[model samples]
Target chain A: MTLTVRLPGPAATVSGRGQRWAEARAGSLLALPAAVYFLVFWVVPFAGAVWLSFTDYELAGVPAWTGLDNYRRLLGDPGFWNSARVTALYTVASVVPSIVLALAIAVPLSRPGRVNGVLRALVMIPAAMPLVATSMVWSAIFADEGLANTLIGLVGIGPRPWLTDERLALWALVIMTTWKHLGLFVIILTAGLQGLPSGVFEAAAIDGAGPVRIFARITLPLLRRTLLFVLVIAVIGAMQSFVPAFLLTKGGPAGATEVLPLYLWATGFGFERMGYASAIAMVLLVAMLALSLVQFGVLRGGDDG
Target chain B: MTLLTRRRLLAAAALTTASGLLAACGGSEPEAAVPADGVPRGKLSVWLHQTKAYDAVFTKLLHSYVQEFGGVDVTPLYVPVDKLDAKLLTAFAGDAPPDLFKIGGWTIAGHARKGRLAPIIPKAMGVPDEKALVAQYDQNAISSLSYQGRLYGVPIDYTICCLYYRRDRFAEAGLDPDKPPATWEEVAEYSKRLTSADGRKVGLQWILGNPQWTLMQLLALVKGKGGGILSADAGTATLASDAGVEALRYYGSVGNAKLSNPLSGFGLFATGQAAMVVSGLFAMDLFPALNKQLVFGESFDIAPLPHWDGGQPVAPAYTWGWAVAEQSKLPYTAWHFIDYLQREDVAARQLKDASLLTPVKGWEKLPGADPKAMEIMAAAAPHADFGPRTPVWQEMAKALTDAGDAVAFGKKPPERAAADFDQAMRIAL
Candidate 1:
């Protein structure tokens, strides 16, 4: 018995191959500007940094090759390791809470309502403002007599040196960072929640499932991919954060908030150690890449199900 | 036939020469040179870190420069002081630095070692030699602007850190405001009486998170106790010496590091939260400017920076100088303009308008100068110590700042902090 299989779409036109070729060519032309932008802005600098990592360029003279010296020195540098630890702590402290809080807010605001729309817009305002301006505002808020202490005072907590004390400076930065970034994540997760199939929720409701049960049984499982995306981006952003720490703490109160980017900057510009800074950049890139891969592997499981 | 051909050739050559001369005259940028009229002709680019008060006085001076030299044009760029170093470094790296700039005395060695600054030409400044140029200003001020025995800049803004105290706070604490703490030990004792119960009001709130000020403050303390940041040969870090440990311990003994003010100690003093601050002559005007209620010599007073109780006197002074870039095409003209800017008359105006001491010889006698402030500065000048001269000045500074903060905030013991600073400095030294 001979079986002839038919596909489930329109038949090929006489000029379909030619049409496809033209379409691809047009698409490539349209994407050319973005491709060039990626090459010029991203690829060139990355490659230059990789090359500079093996040199001894002090930002004043021609780069002289000194293979692996920068990386070797970085290995022994206590400051680098301290900054690495700070970056990791800052990332975990800021990212986990921000995503969780965003989800908590996003679930209720995901519903179709005028009030939700207004709330969503208001939530987006912090993320919309310039990071520098927001950082300055937060600096005031963390002052001794600022709003932060005033709020904590309501709970009978004595005034704390939020930005000045070594024990509290990093936590203060984490709090500011969470507040600064929570809005964008909420909007993103709200979009994700709204995109879930209503049929699944309807079935859960028919089965006598309450809002919490429906959320646990239907919403979360469906929103895994979106959560993964948000988590990866947020982690990357936290890993690269520099401004708040620089402006607020200067990586001080005894190196409490000295994140890697700030350390890299201080090395490159302050000490004129461009080569070592580039090595740091390279290491940071590799770590970020490894992190993203691991996150994808863990969070993206059971896709076929 | 030969005569006619020769005549035509001469005519053509004359026409070509005329056109070339016209093109030279019509060019956008005139070639930097002195014409037969002896007026140096060029466009100058000047970079200065902005102080609102200083900018007004400096701007008028620059305008006068352009007017005085009809053939020259001037472009002045004002950068915020905190960002000036980074901006200047970037400009230098790009081979596009301004013709002239104001640079910290501490950075002179580093920049000069990198071959970025031009050595000052005494002839351009109407002086006979380096000796004559050095004679024009206080020795310590001009010497701080030199590298390896070569003068690189002319000092323009100078300050020796001095104790500033509020008389009202002093009286409230039942201490004589006229006799500000004469030693570090006295400062600690006075701080206890001055500090409020809530730990908000304290005496001598050390400027935190500022590497430059930290170095200056620590320099005075360490050197007063007979220790130095670097050894005599400048080959090793000596910040962990006995005197250094004592200095840092003394530093940590006073002041509440937890005090949160945007302007650090200066803001606290202006608002009557702190009883004393170690600042420059500018603070005399700055306190009143920050708070109109703070009247100099009445509500507040100045005193010589205190020395160690049983140790030698050491006053830490820092200066900013007018320097010409090595890449400048009009070095002579740049120096001439700098000379004009550094005139005794202009220095007097700088003090009057900007409260920026110029450190000119006999500056204490400048007309309209605040007698008390000048007297203190003049006395401090004899013992003034500019921090260690090193090509790795920035690294050394950062290490000192880290150590200072560690001690002041009780993060680490003074001994450990000093040792850590020494270790950090080892990498750069």
Candidate 2:
């Protein structure tokens, strides 16, 4: 009884800290599986690839560490340089045609109708078709005596070696790739057009704006975000392109069509130079990241008005 | 349908499913098919290319092996030619690879170096030694399977690179149909004589644009003139040597003479648009089907690749063989199956059914064999040899082919082409 003293009041609960702790625990619980997956599948492999880039790995023995040598070799490799150039050129060539043709097709068929529906469906046919079958059909079409040449003969144009000629094979890839991928971009832009409020277009038309004026002043400005999205995706897809070059030209006719992916594949799997290939892969990854950043930055800054 | 009963059932089901998944993840390893016993009894997987064309052959041979020996189940998995190598690399990295596979013998050396293959020891095969093994098969076929002085596969098919000529086309060009060129000079003359005046038809069509195809085809010219595309051990490029330049000039003469074009695919050869084509033995099998009027010996025939002036003929060849994977659990069973396939009757039957030339000795005399084709194959067997056996062969092929195209189509001089090739190969090596 004598020792009884006034008990200190229960320590004040820091309400903000309590709330934050509970919220963090809940968030961690929700994100654990995804975090684990990313760590295991992507981050781990990426780390391994980075490590491998510094070593000589041929898949048969212990990887010997030869730091920076693979990267050094890549700098001096003419084949690597040629492939990088091809990859860059192909990315530009394919992305531009795909976006332009997609927009051209999308604008005309933007309005909803039965005929438009059928035409859109027909346009989507090539995109739906597998690249393997498409390659065979295109190969047949490009033959010296193939359907493409046969069709062009009516116009007094001679047979063009679509795939067999070194000067033309890369261009042929660009054309076929445009045809295959145009439909997706068309659908995306069409969806974007349909999402726009039609009242703006109507107001512009009522204000004596021509169709061209309406497009330039209203449509293009509104679709800038969608266009940028499509451009970045198209760029990435074109840079990573493989099958058309692999199946059609086999990176041949004196390495005329040897894009970066094909070259890295040959170096890694074909030549058993996994370390060198990993170095190539790191370079490709960095280049792709830089491209995406610069493009998004420039496109975003270009508008903002 | 009551909620309480359904909840209980659902809980039971979830528990059961989770247990089943765990069990599957930690299941016992499969028992080895080949044991220390009378006969092997289990699934024996055989991987090969062109399964549609070859399933019957593998089915028959493997079935007979099982019937004679003991109990074993065999399956043939067909992979496309383009995907086979990559598929093999993936399979080798995986824990379970095919027990047996058929692949180009020339590629065996590369696979061997990767430790993906097991050496085909003659003693283990029940043959006395490699000499006895060589006695039963064509040496040329066996040579391609050898890696570092040890053979790693059993050669089954000899894909001989020969000169396939059309008699009708040659006669159309005012050349004697009965005579074929035996020398490279004669080849040039024949090309001149066989080409049509209007240029609608050509004298020859070698696969030109593809570096791999062009280089392999041009090996005949290089090898015939006492030259080679690689070092003896296949570690360096010899394609820049004087002999190689001479070979490129010989290859370029086709375009220079206007006997062929650069972009012609095998279609030109198949449609008889070209009189003579440098192709493989397999081309003959497609002639009658491709060109209706064609008769085997009457319309088309194969001749050993023509040699350079006063030089020995060279039938540059590629072979496909049966190899045992290093991951094979039933190695004995796999080897035994290959052993059975190489038996005289089975090897003979393959040529007849599969339209592939067998490497087994006396395969030419097998039933369902054509007399004249057999004669040509027999004559060519002694001279047939493969390209460089190094894993770098793909690059070597590309360099030589680039040289070939520059000289042939780009009109670059042989010396210039060789210099470029030498420079490229310096990087490749």
Candidate 3:
């Protein structure tokens, strides 16, 4: 029921304030279940991980409280250091190409044409596929006698060990990662392009500006915020890549593709060192946050320029 | 919001609450007790790994078990191989482990040490005594199932590796189709002769898909060179000994010989792109049915797996077994079920249907099993032994595989791999 109050005074003093306040209270109560769910499921588990990181928790037995021991060990451990280096390389190799390729494709698909629309739809098919199912195809594609070599062989390039070759495994993973995720970014950038102001473009065209000039001065600067979101999400996604590495290489050909997340999993389950895995995960979380913040700052800093 | 909307929301919330409460009330036990004479009466939950072609056969066997026992309601749980470890761990941690679980034989000792497996009682197995039971299996097989001189699980199947060669490939290379290479030197020579000039068709296909598989096969070669991967007590790794180094060098040179065209041995051998492999009876199932080029006994044949020229022949036994869980309430019932499956005729039928070799003696003489396949396995069985029997055995296995991979990649020579393998085992143990 709609309730109202009557007061004979100034317009500001009249009526419906209590009803508005009641409405807000009702809305908050409706959201309480979702807030409680997040608190119980995500917040509590995250807090538990933080607590376990400082201790020696193997999950099979009682966890012993050992202050900063896991962290100290992680810092000094050669495997941890190697994994960090590999993760960094993997993040860069996957993210930079993904963003560039996404933008490159988005620009073509953003135009008004039937061909562009059809091409956009076709490219988005992989984005809908389950990564686990696609991983099998990728494994086949990266095999020694896979289609990659077959195609390369046609031009006399001969066969190359795409997965087994230690130097190339990370790159092969990067390329596959890009193939799987590039469609999402393409759609994001395409939507961003659609939201771009047409008057500005028309004005630039009227002022005798070329496509390159207009894009350089207007489109890129305008798309900074969207690109920033894409970059941050990409970095966070790249850091946590596990299934592909797990199924494809298993961090092998000499631990060349052992990203931080893969190492974290191996330590936790394979070796049953949960505390050390949690400690490494905490570090990864911090790295992801820091990189995301830096991306925000740099992308925003470009607004003034 | 309207009164009607509020009323509808309240009804929805109440419905959800009612459903939640209903779900929280777990299922009750069956009202009727199992009517059996000697058999224990209860619901028995047995967890087995997934086998697409044989799960139904096992389920049928379970039904027969139910009919024989009268009232025991047996629940068969099939876990996928990849997820079995996680599920078992979760089940144990949750204090709701199954009555019996089929696990890799190599891990029987490891799990037994963790108090996960219940010791098998001879009475439960219908044997006169534990002595008689122990006497039934070979020394190595029996010893592998025992922990601190106490038997804990029953070995069901044994996978003994042997040399599988293509008769057509041999004929193409102008070599003897009847006699496969019997020594490392002969294998090396045969590999070169059998390899295609363009390097497309490989001579020998090794288990390069996973390092663990490679390490398992290499154990046989390592044994022939007189280097034990682990000590008798599984206390120390002796992989860096003179014999161990020679074995590593020998295997490394074969891998490095460039005779291995494709690393995927299963696919290469199935497609007839590779001539030979050291494999189990798994190929007997895949090749005859799936291989477009293969015809059983005519195009392909098996012999005892080759080893070093001057060394004794060896083959690694990849075995799995069934054990009653310590947490089981129906331990006797579980044992009865396992015992039923292991009876002479039933055991032969079960294994034969799956193209698997039995762990029991005289299975070769039983009906249903492929005679030729049994003959080949029996020839190798005398020389077969499991990898190792330590709590840290798997860790050592990993180290061996890593060292083998390093050898394959030329990152480490055989001597260095052996040295590093010894160091790794020390760290792992």
Candidate 4:
């Protein structure tokens, strides 16, 4: 008698519950492919790399556990220190100029104009160009008899060895990296600038704020999140700077431009020190993580202020 | 309700199917192919760094071999010489590697030490009888293919360093085009005479920034003066010895005398701006293509490297060869291809086509061969000395270059640089 009473509306309730369950099951099943891909490609390789860092793994032979030996060797190695210093110098030198140049260009170009679209498209050309092609073109430009020197010479400056001189090699790399990445930074920052609410700027203008004042107080403050995003990206890009250092310098001019990635490549590929390379990669990962955290903290603090 | 759910499910499935099909259509063609014969079924890939003459010859050779041996299909992968070592190592570490490859002699020991090389003597391909091969190559050239007292590779070509001069430039500069320099002193004297600064043209050009070539030439000078870069056993660094220091000073003096233009050397040599340049026989094929007439001469009078004051001259020889991977499945097939390539007729044709000197027994003396090729072979055959043959030869070579660059760039005195180089060798060795 109780069941018969409940059955009066239970059919609809049961159907509703069954539909929700089916939808959730379908959603999870749809997600399964991506989950499998991520597990196989990313997670497995990353775990393997970390595990290999603790072993004496030569590429040609079986890996044997030799815990901390690679780390110990890395600590005492002068080359490692040299690489760390160069990497830091490279990051600061490349990222700072890139961001500054992007901001200077993008902020102005974000405004409407007859040539704004053309100019923005032009800025993105370098970003679309292949890294190897850019490096090759820059190599020609930085050659001893290249265009950079030709221009410098016209200004009554002596032809300097841009790629060959130890003192100037890193600067050459900085210029190359800045040029290569300026387009990307501009695109990101321009998007951020474009997304800012125009009403805030209009209000500022109505209050007798000049263009510079409006930008400083209203526009910039509002674009903080976007700038933070660009900063994070630039930092990551700078830390992984390889192509410029590799192609232009070959970590040369007496190892003046050697960085961690190049050193890792040389050790693993050139010298066949797989475990050591893995260890270096692990250190690089940790360093990158620490840098990201620091950048995050600074961004948060700026937002609060 | 069930019908509606089924419709939604079918639509989602259709979307995924369309996306996957689009992806498949956009992706590159799958490399794996089913072989006609069940034997030699997998892909047979060869990695090479020769993008010019050797590359052309290799492509042709691969075609011939695939026609000759029907089971295996071959793919030739090209890498730049500077990037080859790194790429090979990365590929070897992964699940797939080229079935066979050619590498520089300096790289053999390092790869062999890691057991990456297929031992030709016992495990894989049996070593060829040295006596049955060409007579132009010396024992040392054969020794370059050996690791730990066993042969691991087959010699392909020998590239000897010599003085390449522009016959027209030398004649124009009032130097005898027929007779090049016979000694370091002679080279300096000729360079000074040939050097001219008309507007912007400089006479002799040498690459100052490159340490390897500069150091290798310097080592030749040292050996010519009766000294070696290391002990015979490779137990010590002898770069700071009197002969070594003297060699460095001499090489530095070429830059110091302003006989050679450091700024314009690489470009000038390519453009025929320099009257005489010290380069390898490998450039013989290139000169003809550069719209220039080139004449070949030995390091000293088409003889051995110039003799020191009272010592016999020593010339440095460069050899490159082919090695089989230890992990290879078809060792006999690999051996067959290598042996076939070394046959007199095949070797001669390759040498003629590629403008390379074959290391096989008597391909140099083949009738109707290019005269310049013959002259180079004759000049380089005697007094040829292979560079240091250690597992760490590349590192040692780098160390030597660092020292040489210091001298070439005038960053440090030759003596001081040699000392530093010796110290570096000590650490690296």
On a 0 to 100 scale, what is the lDDT of residue A58 in model 3? 53
DockQ for all models, in order? Answer: 0.48, 0.23, 0.26, 0.16
Error of 3 at B162 (Å): 2.0
Per-residue lDDT tens digits for candidate 3, residues A1-305, read 99999876644754588767878899999999999999999999999999989887655567889899888777665457768999999999999999999998998799999999998888898888999988889888877778888988999997877877777888889988999999999999898888888888899999999989988999899899889989999999999999888888888766778889988886777556688789999999999999988988889743312
Q: What TM-score fits each model? A: 0.90, 0.85, 0.84, 0.78
lDDT of 2 at A106: 95
Candidate 1 or 4, higher DockQ?
1
True contacts kept of each: 0.59, 0.28, 0.11, 0.20
- Model 2, span B1-429: residue lDDT tens: 666688899999999999999998766664453355535556689878863445777777777777886677788788877678778877876656798998877677777887888766564466877778877877777777878888788787677677888888777777777788878888888877766666556676677765556766778877777778877866666777778888888787763222223235455666777778887766666666566788877888777777788888777778888898876766767777778787777766777777676677766677655667677777887777777777666666666776787677654798887876766666667
Write the residue-wise lDDT of candidate 1 on A1-305 in tens digits.
99999765434553767778989999999999999999999999989999999999888778999999999888777678889999999999999999999999999999999999999999999999898999999998998889999999999998888998888999999999899999999999999888887877888899899988877777887888888899999999999999999899889877889999999999999999899999999999999999999989887852212
Superposition-based RMSD of candidate 4 using all C-alpha atoms, in angstroms? 8.2
Candidate 1 residue pairs in backbone clash: none
Which CAPRI tier for candidate 4?
incorrect
* TM-score between candidate 3 and the true structure: 0.84
Residue B373 displacement in candidate 1 (angstroms)? 1.9
Model 2 agreement with the true structure over A1-305: per-residue lDDT tens digits: 37767754334544777868988999999999999999999999999999999999877778999999999888767678879998999999999989988988999888989999998888889989999999888887777678988998999987776676667889989988999999889988888888888888889888999998988888888888788889989999998998999888887655678899999998887777889999999999999999999888866733312
Question: What lDDT score goes with residue A89 in model 3?
Answer: 96
Model 2, residue B167: distance off in Å is 0.5
Name the 10 consecutive residues with the lowest summed lDDT in model 4 chain A.
Answer: A296-305
User: What tens digits encode model 4's per-residue C-alpha lDDT throughout B350-384?
Assistant: 77777665565554575544666566656666777
Please report, as a residue range, the 10-residue window in candidate 1 chain A with the lowest summed lDDT.
Answer: A7-16
Q: Rank the candidates by lDDT, best first.
A: 1, 3, 2, 4
* Full candidate order by DockQ, most accurate first: 1, 3, 2, 4
